[model samples]
Target: MSDPAARLGLGLAAIARPAYITSGRSGDLGDERGVGTLRARTRELLDAGYAAGIRYLDVARSYGRAEEFLAGWLADHPEVDDVEIGSKWGYRYVGGWRMDAATHEIKDHSLQAFTEQYALTHELIGDRLAVYHVHSATVDTGVLDDARVHRAMAHLRDEGIRVGISTSGPAQGDAVRRALEVRVDGEPLFTSFQSTWNPLEPSAGPALAEAADAGARVIVKEVFANGRLAPGGGDGTDGARAAADLAERAGVPLDRLAVAAALARPWARRVLLGPVSVAQLASNVAGAELVLPSGVDDELAALAEPPERYWATRSARSWS
Candidate 1:
């Protein structure tokens, strides 16, 4: 066996198993049970991921019918319990968006709503949940410090759930910093921080590193730059070459290189990926075992240098 945490160098290469196999109204992957092709094809991906030792499972309430799909899948297949399942709350899905809005963008973080949403998990997801989040990705400077949300989260933690926040969007790093600064009776606010991190988007690096120094665990999302930075894929040609060359040199696939790069970063405590199929999952875990060619990062960083959209300037300057 490997160190799991250490071999990832940065952390383990976790198969993200995206809640959304396809985009949904909530900005998360809507469920795919209706997708006839997916229904028949993904059992291999799940089996392969578990065989490859991926131990973390991530999904959210607003991610289409993800929880329902997971429940159905796991119920039919009881062999997939070795991994930890983490889900998020604090948001709702309606009107083609997944933001928190009780009535026209107010953003519900009330202890009442939070608890209601939390309980919904057991109903839709059964009792396999291993971690929970405050849905930090939906929060901003406007509501990061709310008492109702924080209090309910604290209550959940005291009850023995591994509570954390899911931060996405521009000011994600700042959100991580703020989440880190929060404390209860002098104790830290969160145990883990999930953010968008990849070679193309290092926006979370500063905060992630700071959190690492502060002894907080880090779980990285967007390890593949939302699937653009992976092998044989991308909207532009920017870092593709560097990624390909490095992938070859490392004797690993491009997507694996992307994931391995994340896992290898000191501040990165976990690498979460979204594998649409089982082969992809197997390929990802195998790639994690590859050691990058010397200085491949320099090439990657160079190719990844050109400024672009969210994928390039990963920094979240939008929170204000």
Candidate 2:
């Protein structure tokens, strides 16, 4: 198998914004959420991740100026040349940098959303943007069936940028399968997929495997389940308690165990780690190096919750 570190990507979701839905953010990020503070922090994470051999950097337009922060880092660090950048559109950040905002992001998967966001991303990230994904694509959204959107994505592909989709919710598998059938001029439109697939939400595993078999890049996000699987994190749910016990029995940290399980998946070409601090980043790197013991897989497999229940719980989480 290839070295796990080579397959680990640093995701800017947690660190790019002040308030997020991930657990333990109050402790991880503290009260300093000014634009300058986050910009500096993003630079620190980018530097640390690059030094640790993480080449792929994941971001999104809805991640509160994440593309802008990444662009600034790239400009300052011209010597680092081997980074692969992947970003998502379809969601617009509406938090206004305030934690009390009723809405943090607004999702729009229309051609208008793609056109506007793509222009912004390209303006900031330029040629460094290698893969552009339709953020949070779902079956009900009809983004996969939109011919106008397909043509726009195909144009991007023609310019050498791979078009892809990042799925969310309980229907991620369905969305992934639908994306597979999306063809422009008889050629496959999507060549990469990003989806949440922690031990608690392995519902997308089968469809992701099918995508890999079709020669598409598969990136696993939220492997820590938005901090539910991390150490000292999680609500008092049965799955959370079971995961804690299993991690203890495996003699590894909860987050590391979660990461190892995600990495162990044969279809997971790249597993994204969203760490708020350098210490967390180091721990995540250790997770990539971990080798889980036998039978632990079965224990982890048993921790999965019903997709609807799991997503319902996720939807209720408060952004801090």
Candidate 3:
């Protein structure tokens, strides 16, 4: 029988590379990397990813000109219309490219934010954009409760762009469940959900599974726990050890193992590979092809912690 990890999906359009996920890591943010070098490296990575079969690219308005960077890349590759572009709204980039800015992004989930970000995204990406998600939707954000925002998202759907939400904080499961219920004209308004789901914070898995069962596409973000799940990090010492053992058994690096663990979930349509460099991307690509042995998922699930503890650690991570 074919390997389950080899299954294809609409999100990334490839099976052997964490769906070959792409994001704006090369953009300015907490990264102190030089702008000239960052831009050039981002462009090179885009070309390399495309050549390596990565179709889905994730960006956001808050990702420090990430949309602009992606726009520039797309302009040079007009022949690559089949690439799936997904971006998040609701947060504005306030860093002004400052590496040490007091605040890098500011979140506002009101309909006004959605309207403005949508227009900007449209202007930058044109027709190649596939999905637009609300950045970091939470229980206190009131975005799920905002009828005006729902209506605006419905209008975007009418315009042929898929709408969704990316959940953050301890209430991510609640966020996804609520997003699934958003409706327009008696139909679901949203059709996708992005959530954090590493071994350390698998609490969101049940909601994501429900989302998949409801026919909504589910994308797994922070599959590495924001680099904690990588080879070396300061968070979750015990869980890191467990991941290392799993990687050793699987004959892959810790980063690849972490990604493969995310892909092992049946509900995952795509796993975002947030590599900051070309070398890291190459390592993460191995995850798409490395299927974990039986029982690994259960073992990883055992490491799951309460949502509060999991999110608290993530909140403390420095942008660097």
Candidate 4:
């Protein structure tokens, strides 16, 4: 295997490593310290990621001003270059910054939602945006089947931007297959893809491999199963212990082993690091340094939970 930390091209920019930063907790509604504190913390994490040699940042319109926070960070660090910014559309943040909203985000895969969210993202990040993806494009969403939405995405690609779809739900493989078949003017409309691939839900593996082989940048998300792979998380008790035992045998931290398994996949061009704190981000970075023994991935696969069961656990998790 090549050095995982070496620069790897994804779309218009070359990500410094196979690991990228994701603003999963940076815009949390549960953090009651107000926007000031949240932005400050997010800025701090971004700075840490940059300093740690991360060159890719993932944000979304539904991540509650994540683009705005990143824009501010960019404004402050005007000299920073080679940093690729990837954001997503198709979901609107409806939480209104309140911790107790009936819902946090709502999904809409129509052309109107894409146009509106594209404008919002452009206003915030402007030309710094690198790759723009459709948020949670599942087979049931029929985003790829919608001609209007597909054409709009192609138009964005024509504007010197790489367009892709981030898939969720159990039918992610089907979504990936559909994206691979989408074309505009004899060219593939999407050049990148993001999908969940963790020990519990490795069902997307074969399709992701096919996407990679078809020349699409395959970015892996939810590798840690949204923190369930972490020690003592409530999602999987027995699996967590098994992970701990495996990590101990490998002489690495449990989280590092979890992330390394994702990195080890042949199709994974980049794995999004959804760290909530600076320490967690550092640990995720260390995942690149891990050199797990043979059969580690197979051992981890034994802990796999049913796809529906895995997603159900993730859905029940608190945003906090």
Which candidate achieves the best lDDT against the true structure? 2
Winner by lDDT between candidate 4 and candidate 2: 2
Model 4 scores what on Cα lDDT? 0.76
* CA lDDT scores, all candidates in order: 0.62, 0.93, 0.74, 0.76
**RMSD (CA, Å), each prediction:** 6.1, 0.8, 5.0, 4.9
Where does candidate 3 clash, by residue pair? 17-20
Report the Cα lDDT for candidate 1.
Answer: 0.62
What's model 2's lDDT at 205? 98
Question: lDDT tens digits, residues 1-320, model 3?
Answer: 15432332212111111111122233312334555655676776677666656767888887766777788888887798777789989888776655457776789998888888989999998888889999999878898989988998998898889899998888888999988888898989889898888898988889999999999998888887766677654254676677777777766788877878888888998887666566766777777887777887787788787889877766765544
In model 4, which runs have C-alpha deviations exceeding 4 angstroms?
1-3, 6-32, 234-236
TM-score of each: 0.77, 0.99, 0.89, 0.90
Count of steric clashes across candidates, in order:
6, 0, 1, 0
What residue pairs clash in candidate 1, if any at all?
A: 10-263, 20-29, 45-278, 137-166, 170-316, 171-316
TM-score, candidate number 1 = 0.77
For candidate 2, the per-residue lDDT at 304 reads 96
Q: List the candidate 1 regions with Cα displacement exceeding 4 Å.
A: 1-43, 77-81, 94-113, 136-141, 245-251, 303-308, 311-320
Q: Write the per-residue lDDT of candidate 2 for residues 55-96, one digit (tens) a residue.
A: 999999999979999999999999988989999999999999
For model 1, what is the alpha-carbon lDDT of residue 319?
A: 11
